[model samples]
Target: MRLSRRLEKLPPYLFVEISRKIAEKRAQGIRVVSFAIGDPDLPTPPHILDALVEASRDPANHRYPETEGLPELRQAIARWYRRRFGVELDPDTEVLPLIGSKEGIGHVAFCLIDPGDIALVPDPGYPVYPMGTVLAGGEPYYLPLREENGFLPDLDEVPAEVARRAKVLWLNYPNNPTGAVADLDFFRRAVEFARRYDLAICHDGPYTEVAFDGYRPPSFLQAEGAKEVGIEFHSLSKSYNMTGWRIGMAVGNAELIRALRDVKSNLDSGIPQAIQLMAIAALDGPQDCIDEHNRVYQRRRDRLVEALRSLGLRVNPSPASLYLWARVPEGETSVSYTTKLLEEAAVVVTPGVGYGPSGEGYIRLSLTLPDDDLEEGLRRLEAIAHGRPVRL
Candidate 1:
């Protein structure tokens, strides 16, 4: 079948490939222990779920939702930002609801990128970032998120010509796949860079609430001068175990927010009213679930890190997010190691190369599974590491 040039430029969505491999293993009757995707296994808190049920039952909510979002829900998101980050937002103009941060990210890119423009994207970052640029006919300039840089992009290293031509700079902290947390200083530098480059700064912050060690991730808007140059995407998925709820918020620069909303308005309907109400409850209600969720993820992170280390894999447990980014064992590429783990041990993990070229010899394991399932996955990994022939 013939495809559009833009469609051909895109690679297979990362998780889709992982899911396919997992399904293939399942078809062969293997009970694969998956640590690939970051979809939380925890159920949504009852309060949020109840809010959804109540809203869904109301006839008033049956009609089309406001494309900008329900005002009350936007206010709830604004309140969340104010309370957590000390960044006051004009919810009416500065905040917009998303069908998860993923969708908002693409829309933001499309809003800013013209055909053949440049976009600065993190290597080993979320696939959506580069894909959005590609779909918009923009060229992606990958900034290596190396260990020496503490996994933050070194803006000065960006080519002067590329920086001048770029229309968007995409960033995320407590990042997907890598789990690298960005500090306020990093955001400050990023804001300054974007200001100088005159590009839109798009920060995806879905894992902000899923942090540990008493570490709360800050929003990009919290940085001095950040609101002048950037917008942040916040998701309820990780924070409230509301992955299927499809509610998120875009906040920061009012202009950027409006631009993204304009793009979204043309392409999609706003979030469902029931889900919007549920998001309100999730945000404005008690944040105890966030702390409790992080606690569980911390335990799983520590356990999995220890288990991987015991098998001589070099892994650092991230203080934020549900990922353990580890170097592949020497002598094997990311694909080779990940493929071996899947076929021989029935252990599923994401290959780092799927993230970018810089991720060549690394692998990412998500800590989103239950304790027992995670333990079983660790045991399988250990068995493979010990060079044992397989038997479940």
Candidate 2:
């Protein structure tokens, strides 16, 4: 059978490969403690699950759902924006529920990119940004996010011709892989850059609520004129321990929201009504769960940072996001360091290079593991750091 050229061009997804490696080790009867994926180990809040159970019991929820989500769900998302960021949104026009933010992030590419169009994607960023553009017959012009730049792209460095040809700009705060946080000022600049280039900005903000140290990440829409040129994708996955629930939303420019909605309407049905109810419960329900979850993550982050620093790996005590982006020991590449930890210590971490070339010297460890597993993993890492052999 012949595969499409696009499919041929795509590389294996990063997380899937990590899962495969983990399975291989587990199959061999080896116990591996992984800090690989950023999936929360915590449970969804009880109130939200109650909402799902109630909704699921209704016969009305079993049927196919509208591609545009329920009015209540959209309104809940709007209310969330207003209360959290003081950003007003027209639920009917600027908000669209998604099966998951990943779905919206990928489909939004089809909305803006025509064949041969360019998307300005961040290097060492979310794979979906570039992969989605490629699948949509668009080229991705990668912008390197250097440590010196606080992981924010320099808009002025984008060549004039490239900017002119680019159709979209992808930004993520509390970013994946890097655990980098961006301020509203950076977003304001991005909004200006998008307007100057006539590019639509696609800001992935799933990690916004997964912050630590009392740091509240700002929404892109909070920036003046952001609604004129960009849409932000947010997910309940990280925020509410709802990764398995697969409910999220896109909000911002009305036209962009409509375009994405139209694309989704034809491609697939909307989120399950029960799940939508759960999401509404999440958004409108008590927000204290977020603070509670962040507290747990903060504890884990502090312990991990101290351990990594002692081992001579450079890692910041990230203020937001459920990840610790650590530089590999000198003379080791991301893949080599990751492989050493997996094979030698029976520990698993993501090789940063999987995100992009600029990530070649780093590794990302997730803070979403259970406390016990985290301690065990740290112990193994310490054994390796101290030049002691790890027990198989």
Candidate achieving the largest lDDT: 2
Off by over 4 Å in 1: none
- What would the C-alpha RMSD of candidate 1 be, to one decimal place? 1.0
Model 2: colliding residue pairs: none
Write down the lDDT of every candidate, Cα atoms only. 0.88, 0.93
Task: Name the candidate that leads on TM-score.
Answer: 2
Report the C-alpha lDDT of model 2 over 55-167, residue by residue, as the tens digit: 99999999999999999999999999999999999999999999889999999999999999999999899999999999999999999999999988899999999999999
Candidate 1 lDDT over 125-149, as tens digits, reads 8988899888888899999989877
Q: Assess every candidate by TM-score.
A: 0.98, 0.99
Backbone clashes, each candidate: 0, 0
The TM-score of predicted model 1 comes to 0.98
